[model samples]
Target: MIELKDVYKTLDGRKILQGLNLHIREGETYVIIGRSGTGKSVTLKNIIGLMKPDSGEVNIMGQCINNMGKEESYALRQKMGVLFQSGALINWLNVEENVALPLVEHQRHLSKSEVQSIVQHKLELVELEHAGKRMPSELSGGMKKRAGLARAIVGNPKIILYDEPTSGLDPVMSNQINDLIISMQEKLGVTSICVTHDMSSAYRIANRIGMIYEGQIIEEGTADQIKNSQNPIVKQFISGSTVGPLTQ
Candidate 1:
């Protein structure tokens, strides 16, 4: 459902993505794992049109994002949802209101009641139905992430992009979030692309895993295939070995 071909991106004269190429199929969870500053999040921005590549093409459902008009971009974005790294919740807004913001902003034609209904349904899906009235600051890290997820899916998007979905939680909470991601994909049938440094989370949630190194996708396959990869870079990354090409 998503494809990046010969993509190159540079920020402030520093290259972030170099001839990066990736393909994500429908109804599957694809995880991109890489060291910090290796362009994992940059790849997502390119996919969503938040950042345009200096060269090459990014296509979502066969629509070239770099060439889209405002209306076309808006329509394309309507089909996708993003759960930001920090939850990106509006601290002042309560959970329900935060979840409803997408509908309020993009789907203004819906009545207040309809928007509430959709928000509540998403909250329930994330097992946070009772926490709707709570603010982001009042929720735990996991709860905030769940709330962010609720907001993402409230629009009923076809694709979900998760940025470091299990970043800051404890192991138990991380596992819970991973379960939620899996359940959401199974229940909603939405194509998912996740960028994370956590190998365990990546292994648990990804149907396929791609390793990004030096701004390019160097290895990609099923979880098992990635685990057994003979590439030194991929092995060093997944094994968490510091005595390798990657440096601090």
Candidate 2:
């Protein structure tokens, strides 16, 4: 449902993505794993049109995002949701209001009752039915992530992009988040693309995994394939070894 072809992006004369290419199929959980500064998040931004590549094409569901008009871009974006690394929740807004913000902003025609119904359902899906009145500051890290997740799916998006969804959480909480991601995929059938360096999380949630290195996708396969990959860079990364091609 998403494709990035021959993509190249640079920032301040530093190339972050060089001829990067990736494809994510429909109804599948695709995870992109890489060390810091390897363009995993950059690739996600390119997909969502938050950042355009200096050169190359980013296509979502057959339309080139880089070439879309304002209305077209808005329509396209309505089909996608993003859960950022930090949850990106507005501290002042309560969980219910935060989850309803997308509907309030993009779907203004809906009545307050309708919006509340949608928000309530999303919160329930995330198992935070009683946290609606709570503020972001009042929630635990896991709860914050769940709140962010509720906001993301409140729009009923066809695609979900997760940026480090399990970051900073304990092992148990991380596993819970991973389970939630898988649940969303199975229950909603949304195409998912997760950008993270957490190998365990990736292995838990991804139907397919792509290893990115030096701004290009060097390996793409199932978890078992990735584990058995012979590429030195991939091995070094997945094995968490320091004595390989990847320099410290």
Candidate 3:
């Protein structure tokens, strides 16, 4: 389980997260939706310990990560995986090598062949086994995202964080990524937290959706509740309307 309690963050005198409280159960897909610059991506960074909240606690798997030492934090990180918006693949490395990078760095006990096998398995999981020898530039946008997904799960992490997974893709490619996410979750049963502005993707894959506005989670519920919510902010956001509390 992951929990954030009264989390507050500020950078250069600007508040990004304010008293953000959230709980995500294991083996569940939680999607966070918000307009641009609403601190959606910042929340993911805080969860992964890449950014520290100015106040409040970030607890992952019952451990207060904010107070953990470097060694402890490193150990905790091994249990989590992150898929950045751009895939963040190494330009010089082949697909398999990119996926195996995490395992090679963290699990030194595994021989080269073992790492390769693990890489192959993860690639197969993302339906990209044949593209293992291809570079990031050689793959299409969807393919690159799949490669990134393959790399994210190479270690069989308990939790996976996706930051704008469908950002720059067309609607078709976006849906394909959503289907892949749903399939992978069912196959592996990993806890997923996806931060995206794509409501269609959220409705398709998320078991529960949280709407963030002005640095706070103003509404959260099942997809149906979000769709029917009478809350002005929620309605406005779902409809993509420029007129609402958010625009003020």
Go through the candidates in order and give the clash count of each. 0, 0, 0
Error of 2 at 157 (Å): 0.4
TM-score of 2: 0.98
Model 3: pairs clashing at backbone N, Cα or C within 3 Å: none
Model 3 agreement with the true structure over 1-248: per-residue lDDT tens digits:
99999999887888889999889999999999988877888899888998888899999999999988999989989988999899999999999999999988889999999999899989988889899999898999999999999999999999999999998999999998999899878999999999988889999999999988878898999999899999998999899998988788
Model 1, 1-248: lDDT tens per residue?
99999999999899999999999999999999988999999999999989999999999998888978889999999999999988999999999999999999999999999999999999999999999999898999999999999999999999999999998999999999999999999999999999999899999999999999989999999999999999988898899898877754
Error of 2 at 217 (Å): 0.2
Model 3 stretches astray by more than 4 angstroms: none
RMSD of each: 1.0, 0.9, 0.9
**Candidate 3, residue 70: how far the Cα is off, in Å:** 0.3
Off by over 4 Å in 1: none
Give the range of the ten consecutive residues with the poorest summed lDDT in model 3. Answer: 34-43
